[model samples]
Target: MSPTDTDALADDLLAYIDASPTPYHAVRETARRLEQAGYRALDERESWTLKPGERVYVTRGDTSIAAFHLGTAPVDRAGFRLVGSHTDSPNLRLKPNAQVAKNGYQQLGVEIYGGVLLHTWTDRDLSLAGRVVLLEGGKPRGHLVDFRKPLLRVPNLAIHLNRGVNTEGLKLNPQEQMVPVLGLESAGAVDLRAMLVKELSKGGVKAEAADILGYDLCLYDLQPSTRSGAHEEFLHAPRLDNLASCHSSLTALLTGPASREATSGVILFDHEEVGSRSAQGAASPFLRTLLERLTLVLSDGKPDAFHRAMAQSFLVSADMAHAVHPNYASLHEPKHQPQMGAGPVIKSNVNQSYATDGESWAYFAALCREAGVTPQHFVTRTDLGCGSTIGPITAGQLGIRTVDVGNPMLSMHSIREMACASDVAAMVAVLRRLFA
Candidate 1:
């Protein structure tokens, strides 16, 4: 690809992150793109009759999606080439009955979600976004709500109050120091329900305050995803930990036209940051159910087709790789420090933290070469415990040969993260080839 094409891809990525402030929004955007690409959307509540050479997709819990392009051959013969990524990231989530009046201010009570970098959230402009389940015609409906303006802020304690902050580092109490101020304390304190009703009203969605059954909203940094550095070579955005992988997967899934020799799909899951234990998480039966249904359809209900398909399937677990941070080089495994802009990263761990074995890594590396790109590698320092991805969970659950890979990135769980523009192209290239 040309440099111009690379820049366009990076621009699309920044826009994708800006448009998706929450998991619900990310899945919505992905589904929209899939539909525009001629993929039929499937309702999980209904029976599926998918056929070979058909493109289709399905969503569960409105936060997870699986999209597929069935091959020209039967499932037992063709197998599947899959890429997986999660939709959720670390952040602060609003609690039920969230509004609180405290210390001469009206604030929202929030719970820390996932492995949040508490201090990075301090003083950043924050907004609200997530799903609000409301009663519509006596039936529950989930609405995507995003007040994409700076409506909340967690202000840091003044230097005068804590003089040793710089030397001792900023320590935050999630319960005490992380509450975001909504407004001044007055007779009419900020009502969380009223705010949601009004925000919904702007989009012509009418609902009474009492009609709202429940909500799963989170605070996101309001800064737009952008690039920096001398040559505009770096990406700085929120949710890049997994969203970048989501973008790559979606891009690759759309690159095909439903005529490949093998089955190919992308799985965007939710709740990975919080141990992936949720209904829509990788640990759940979401992907397995979809694959089984697909196999059942393509194999004409053969007795052992599902098992045969599983044996021939391959999964590339795409997540962000930890780039070698210049300031903290010692934290990385010296021999396996991946770099931004170098290429796609093949992440592996012997302890099964990342699900990449020698064979799987070699396969992914070969795919990178086939895509006209080199591959980088990542393994945590031997002394430090490794963090896991959906790779192991899905691999173990399905018994599919899985390789974990990603674009190299920095600030893994911070409010905002950074990576290289070129790596976005590199990772997508490899995934596109894998699907091809």
Candidate 2:
């Protein structure tokens, strides 16, 4: 790709990440892109009449999305070429009774959502964005909300209070230390619900505090994604771990040549950070059910058609990989150090943590070669445990050949993660080739 093309792709990715402050927003953003590409949205509650050469997508709980392009051939014979990623990231989620007061200051109670880098979240300009469940027209409804500006902040303890801070490292108590200050008590005891109602009204979403039954709000850094470094080669942003993969997969699906044989699809599941167990998660039957329905529809209800398709299907679970950290070089496997800007990483694990085996690895390696990209490899050190992706979970659930891969980056779960701007286009090229 040319430098201009690379910069454009990176810019679009940063915009996507910035727009998606929560899982609901991420899926909505994905849906918008897909719709612009002529992919029609399908209602799960309504009957689907799918046909070959048709492009359609469906969302579950406004958080997870599945988009696919039907092949010109029989789905059972063509099988599915699918890429998967997650919508959620490690962060702080608000509790049920999120309001709390301490030492003349008001704060929101939060619980750690995943393997978050607790210390990184301190002293950042934080805002709230998520789906709010409300009672409208005598029925429960959900609306997306974003307090776009900095509405909350978690202040760090001064160094003077802890002299051994650098040596002992920062220790945080989620229940106590992580509460983000909204304002001082002198500002008056502001009702959290009332604040939401006011914010909703500002967004033109009419709702009263009494109408808001509940919410799934979470705190996010208010920083915009940026391309840093001397050559502007580095992408500094939040939620790159999986959002980068999500954007790449979606771009490939939309831009790739229309498949004449295999069915191409991308499913961005929610709740991967906490474990893929939700209804729209990879561990659930969302993908399988969709595939089975497509087979039945395309094959005219042929017996065992879903099974036949599964036998030939392949899944590329695209989550961000760990680029060898500059400060912690010894933590990585010596022979398999994935570097930022090197290329996409083919992540592997013997214990099935990543679902990449010999067959799948060879398949993906060949795909990368076809796209003129040099694929890198990653494996956690033997003595240390490996973190997983949706690869193993989806593979086990659907019984499809799966390879786990991603663009490598530093700061896997930090509030802000860094990745190569070029790798975004590289991964897109390979994925588009796979779709082809």
Candidate 3:
């Protein structure tokens, strides 16, 4: 890809990361894009009558989404070409009893959601965004909220108070040190539920404190994603670990040519950062249920057609890969060090952390070669522990041939992460070829 194409794609990726503060928001943004591209939404509770060349999508719990375009050939003859990615990232989530006041200061109690770099969260401007459930006519309803302003902050203790912070490293307790200061209590007690009701009213959603049945809110940095570096080759953003892959895969699905030989699709699952056990996660039956329904509809209830389609299907599990850190070069495998600005990476693990095998690896590498791009390889060092993706779990569930691949990045679980701008375009190009 040329510099102009790379810069354009990087700009789009940054916008996506900035817009998506939570998994619910990510799915909503993706659904917006898919709908703009003429894909219609299908309700799972209702009957679906699908036809060839039809573009359709289905959502589960408003967090996970699967979109597909039927091909000209029968599904049993031409199986699915699928790209998978996750929507969740490591962050702080608000607890049920979140309101707490100490020494005339009000704070929100939070629970760490996943493996987070706790220190990075200190001394940052934070805001709240997620879904809140409200009661309406004796039923619970959900509404998306985005407090776009800096409503809270987690300040770091001064250096003078902790003199050995630099050399000895700073340690924080999630229960005590991680609570964010919302404001000061002036008069009497501050009712947190009433405060939420006021905020919702400002956003044009009328509700009372009694109407709030539940919520799933999280705190996020207020900083906007941007392109940095001398040549603008570096991109810095939040939630890039999996959202970058999600954006690339969605773009590829929308831009790729409608194939006559395969049914092309993309799935963005939720809850991967926290072990993917939810109804919308990869460990659940969401993907398999959709695939079976599609097969049954396409084959007119033919016997064994779903299994036949699975036999010929292929899945490319896309997640962010660890790039060789400049400050810690010795941490990576010597020969298989993936570099920023390099092309996509093909990841493998012998212990089944990733699903890449010889056959699938060769298949993906050939796709990259056909796209005129060089593919990199990644394997964790023998002495170190390896992080996992949804690749292996999804493959085991469906018995489909799967390959793990992604763009190289740094700061895997930090609040703000970095990546090469050029790699975004490269991965999108390879995925476009795969979908075509």
Candidate 4:
């Protein structure tokens, strides 16, 4: 691809992330694109009987989904070419009994659910979104709720009141500072479910509490991702840490009408922001169940064939890589600071935080080279603690050879994140080759 094409692709992907304000929207967009490409939907409750050349998709919850295509040729047990990414991002969340009033101010109590930069949430406009369950007549009605506009905010306390805020640094009390102002009035009794029901009803959806089986909901900034810098070198947005990977994986999945030479699969999961233990998370049965079921479908229930396919399978855990911050260059190891647009990164950790080992990294290095994308290496400072990811967990669970990789970015968990514009296209190119 030429530089112009790369810029076009980055612009396209940034638009997708900007449009996907919530996990539900992300999954919905993904499913819509896959279906447009002729992928059939499957019911999770029923057993799967897949035929060669058939393409299918499935979702565990609104937050996670997987799509794969069966090769027209015999299914290779050596395992499928699996690419994985997370759909969730760090943000404030509403509590079950969320409504509360203080000093005539109507606020919705929120719980800090994951590792987040709390200071970033202050004074920024926020919107409500997520899945809501309600009753339509007698049965449960599952619906998605998105305000898509500014609905609430966590106003910052006046700096004059805390003279030492900058000097001593700021500390936020999640229970206090994180509460989003809902309205001026109390809105009568706190019926959080009812309020949500009414919101969905506006979308032509009517339902009750029992009508709601359950929902995975979250609030997001309605801010759009923008191109910045004099040379248009920087891309700024929310959830870029993994969303970049998510968009790249989705694009790669579509670039193919892939062949039976290998089964290419993509897993966009939720709850990674909170350690991935949920049903739709990496640590759960979603990936394992789907892989096992796929193997059986390919082998026609032959255990030996499934085992062989497993041996041939490979997985790429696509998450965001940290680029060295120019302002904080001292924090990164001199030789290991991966630069923005330097290329795709192959992340490694001896502590097992990332799943990549000698063989897996080598395999990925070959793929990167074939795609003409430079591959870099990442390892945390030994003294500093390392963060964990699904790469390690999924590798252990499936015993599939795996390499962890990502696009290098900065201010990873910040409310608004930044990455190089060219890096997005670079990673997309590498993924296209991997899926190819």
Candidate 5:
């Protein structure tokens, strides 16, 4: 794969990721593509069935999923190749009993989830997306609800009123400033459950407050992702941090062969932005269980072979890398300013924030050569603390030689993020070659 090809696919994948506002939506999009490519879905209650030349998938608690293909020959678990990534990012999550009416205004009460740039969320055109629970004929039902259009806005206080805004740098009070405007008072008292009931009613379901199972809802910018700048060389979008990785792995699976002599897989996890400790997160049994089940099924009940394959597996933890900001260039290390379109990054930190080491880096560099990608290096400033990911956690849990990699991104965790347009397609092409 050439750099040009990777850049093109990156843009395509970024659009897909930007469209998925929640983990459920992310998994749904992935399932759609897999089904299109002739991959069969599995029921959790079904018995194990092993067959050669069949594409397989496993789901855990709705949000996390692992997909792989069986090769013509028996796969060596000891030499398996895996791409690991997460589905979650930093944002605001809706709280239960979320409706709050104040001074004739209707607002949705929300809690900050993960490490988010709170100030970036204010004054943006926002829309809600997540799963909704309902009662259909007295039974619980799940529905994917996406208010695609801009339905709310958290307006910032005027500069004239906030005399300290410029000097103090706009300190945001999450409770007061983050309230999203729903409708006018004449629109009547805004009951959140009632609004949900009304929306679910259209889907043939009767919903009540009690019928509301917890949701993973988020507010996102309503703007569509697109190429920008005079040369049309930059990509502007939201949630590019880890979504870029999710899209790349999914695209690689679809475009690459069904199976190879070695085991190849893609795992997308949830709650990575919040320390990855949930039931479906990197810290749980999700990945381990999926691999064990796959090995058991692929080995035709041969425990010895399955164990061998498990011992030989390798994983690539794909997350977004930080690019050197032109305005804040002083914050980055001089020698390690990872440039956009320079190629994919192998992120490293001595404190284990990233899991890449000498051995893992070398192996990935070899794979990049085979895939025709020029692998780049990323390191943070000496005086600052670095952000962590599922990379080190998964490495500690699975004992796999894991390499941390991603596309360089600017304005990370902002309501609207930016990256080079060419890098998107470049990543896809490289992933295709690696998966092959």
Candidate 6:
């Protein structure tokens, strides 16, 4: 990536991360862009009849999505060139009955979701966004909603109150300190359900408080994603841990030069931060079922077509990798410390935590060489426990060849994270080479 590609892609990524505050919103934003790129949306309830050289996409649970382009040859022969990622990130999710009053202040009770860097969230501008279920004709319908304003706060205690705060960090408890203040009790009761009804009305929907079934709301930082640093070389944004990978892979699938040799696409799953055990997660049969159905349709029900396709298929698991923090250098393996602006990193774990074996990584290494991008590598210290991605999960499920890769980033689970601007576009370049 050149200096030009660096700045422009950062601007584009800032817009993407801003629009996607929740997993549901992330899928919706990606789908909207895919539609503009000429991919036809498919509903799982409907029968699909796709042709060679056609583009199609489908959504499950409104939080996960899979989009692909059929090639000149059937998948049994050419297989599928796939990129997988997750949409969910660590944050504070609202509880079922969230409202509570304490010391004349109204606050929303929240459950700490995933592995959150709890302290980073304090004293930040926070807002809410998620999916709300409404009843219509006695049936449930989900709607995506975002309260774009900074309407919540988790204010930190004063230095005088906690005199040793600088030396001894403030202890946080999810059930107590993590709650965000909504307003003073004198402002009257802040009915969240009633507020949702008014918010839906602004969107021209005839929704009522009585029809509101339930919600999956979470708090997000209201700060916009942007490029930072003295030379504008760094990307400062929220959800960069994985959303950065999501944006790059999706762009490659959309902008990659037309490929007629094989099926090429990207699959994004939700709930990865929470073990990916749900219906819309990587552990579910959603992806396997899609591939099986496509094989049956394209191969005219030929015997063993599905097995043949699996044998030839490969998946690239894209997630953000740990960049060696300058302040905490000893925590990383000295030789394998990845740095920002060093292009994509091929992540591997000897225990199979990352699913990146010799053969799988070699394949992606060749792609990087062909794309003129030099790929970096990430392997945690031997004694340390490494985090896993969706790579091993999907690979084990389908017995497919898979490699784990990502852009180097700092602050893995904080409210705000940082990455290199050049690596963002460099990832897309290598992915394009694979599908080309």
Consecutive 10-residue window with the lowest summed lDDT within model 6: 1-10
Per-residue lDDT for 15-70 in model 2, tens only?
99999999999998999998998999998788899888999999998899999999
| Backbone clashes, candidate 6 | 0
Candidate 4 per-residue C-alpha lDDT over 1-436 given as tens digits, one digit per residue, 9 for 90 to 100: 2422778878877888876777888888889888998998998899987787788999877778899877664555435888999988888877776778887778888887678899998888888888776655667656788877787888888889988998999898887678888777645545567777778878888665445666556778888889999999899999897788988887777776556567888999998988898888999989888877787777655657666777888899999998999999888877789999798999999989999999999999988898788899888987788887789988888888989999899988988999988887778777777767
lDDT of each: 0.90, 0.91, 0.91, 0.82, 0.79, 0.90
- What tens digits encode model 6's per-residue C-alpha lDDT throughout 1-436? 2323766777888899999999999999999999998999988988988888889999999989999988778889888889999999999999999999999999999999899999999999999999899998889999888889998999998999999989987798878898999999998989999988887787777897989999999899999887888889988899997888889888888887676688887999999999999998999998999999888777646799998988988899999999999999999998899989989999999899999999999999999999888999999999899999999999988999999999999988999998888888899889887788
Evaluated at residue 215, the lDDT of candidate 4 is: 58
Candidate 4 matches the true fold with a TM-score of 0.94
Model 5 weakest 10-residue run by lDDT: 1-10
How far out, in Å, is residue 392 in model 1?
0.6
Worst 10 residues of 1 by lDDT: 1-10
Better of 2 and 5 by lDDT: 2
Q: Give the TM-score (vs. native) of candidate 3.
A: 0.97
- Residues 1-436, model 3: lDDT tens digits: 2322877889999988888999889999999999998999999899999899999999998789999988877788788999999999999999999998988888899999899999989888999989889999899989888888897888899999999999999999988999999988885677777877888888899998989999999899999999899999999999999999999999888888755458899999999999999899999999999999999888646798999999989999999999999899899999899999989999999999999999999999999998889999999999999899999999999999999999999998999999999999999999888888
Candidates in order, TM-scores: namely 0.98, 0.98, 0.97, 0.94, 0.93, 0.98
Q: Estimate, for each residue in 192-296, the C-alpha lDDT of model 1 and write its tens digit.
A: 898999999888899999999999999999999888999999999999989999998898778654479898999999999999998999999999999988888
Q: For candidate 5, what is the lDDT?
A: 0.79
lDDT comparing candidate 2 with the true structure:
0.91
List runs of model 3 lying over 4 Å from the truth: 1-4, 187-189
User: Backbone clashes per model, in order?
Assistant: 0, 0, 0, 16, 12, 0
Candidate scoring better on TM-score of 1 and 5: 1
Candidate 2 versus the native: TM-score? Answer: 0.98
Task: Estimate candidate 4's alpha-carbon lDDT, on a 0 to 1 scale.
Answer: 0.82
